[model samples]
Target: MKQLLEILGFIALVQGVAGLVHEFTDWDWGFVQRLDVLDGYEVYASVALLVLGCALLAAAESRASR
Candidate 1:
């Protein structure tokens, strides 16, 4: 279960990074079409995802320390 959380957190981190990249650049993630179509709100969503992923990572850290 813990490993699952770690993997999910990693995925969220990667997606957040990808979202940021989409905001600044013109990169696509294969199936996530419409990379060129976005609003300003995407940045906020990306940051939120990043924060959530970091929080999950921190949770994992505490678990590991135990």
Candidate 2:
């Protein structure tokens, strides 16, 4: 369970960073930018993903210390 959280967190973090980078640099990358539903809200979605990733990682760490 902890491992799963860690893995998910890592993926989210990567994607979030990628999304932000793409938005700022026009790099043409990341899954967030490719979503039609998030046409004008990619930045917000990326920020949410970044926060979720941090939360998941923190949860995994707490679980590990248990």
Model 2, span 18-49: residue lDDT tens? 99999999999899999999999999999999
Worst 10 residues of 1 by lDDT: 30-39
Error of 2 at 41 (Å): 0.3
| Number of the top-ranking candidate, with TM-score as the measure | 2
List, in order, the clash count of every candidate structure. Answer: 0, 0
In model 2, where do residues sit more than 4 Å from their true spots? none
Q: For this target, which candidate reaches the highest lDDT against the unseen true structure? A: 2
lDDT of each: 0.72, 0.96
Q: Supply the global lDDT for candidate 2.
A: 0.96
